[model samples]
Target: MSIQVGDRVPEVTLKRLREGLETIDTYTLFDGRKVVLFAVPGAFTPTCSARHLPGYVEHFNDFRSRGIEVFCMAVNDPFVMQAWAKTQSVPDGLQMLSDGNGEFTRALGLEMDASSSGMGIRSRRFALYVEDGIVRASFIEEPGQFEVSSAEYVLEHLPG
Candidate 1:
């Protein structure tokens, strides 16, 4: 089933690139914190790289100012994600998480197969406001849609 607002995030270990190799789990990463986790189709796609990811990057400070940690996730390897993060100049505070095998995406029921587009398994565009590993809010884009998952939308939904 698709993850919902009140559901606990599934436990999973994901690789994250740091000075050296590092690992993190869903619960540990988000437990006891309000996190804004947004997923895109792939790491370096056109609209994703130019608009989706950049929107979050541009608003990283704003999100943090509201006490929400921002994370960008995609079904690409950590190495590719690291390169993309550098290319986009992603600040240290804005995390780039690699769901390389799509395990996390699939566990959340957000997996999308884009083999027709030669992208393989990817994630549908969505954003979630998670607190202590439970989803507080979820914004899912309709097929071929983008507005709802934008950073501005997530910002507007932040609990006052």
Candidate 2:
């Protein structure tokens, strides 16, 4: 089943790049924080590289001012994620997480097959507002759409 509002995020290990090294299973990172977790199909894809990830990176301060930490995920290896992060002048507050093997994406029921495009299993475009590891809101895109997971959508959902 798709994860919904009020659902606790499954205790899944997420691969991330830190200090020039790959870090795995860092679930403790989200503990006691309000996180805006967004996922894209893959790293360095056109939409993901040019729009989706950059949108979050740009509005990271806005999210922090509202007491939310922004996290981005994709079904790429940590090295790719790290290189992608370097490609942009990413702000310090936004975190780039890699679901290298798609385990975390699969656990969230957010995995999708993109083999036709030469990208194996990947994550669907989606975003969630999580507080203390429980979902407060979720915005998942319809297939081939970017209407819901934009920065503006998350801003609109943020409390005043």
TM-score of each: 0.97, 0.94
- Residue range 67-110, candidate 2, lDDT tens digits: 89988899888888888888977777688888888888988898
**After aligning candidate 2 to the native by TM-score, how far in Å is the CA of 127 from where it should be?**
0.5
Best by TM-score: 1
**lDDT against the true structure, each candidate:** 0.90, 0.84
Query: Residue by residue across 1-160, what tens digits does model 1's lDDT show?
Result: 7899899999998888898667889889999998999999988888899899999989999999888999999998999989999999999988889898889999999988799999899999999999889998999887778998999888987765
Candidate 2 regions with alpha-carbon error over 4 angstroms: 20-26
What value does the lDDT take at residue 153 in candidate 1?
Answer: 88
- The clash tally of candidate 1 reads 0
Among all candidates shown, the one with the greatest lDDT: 1
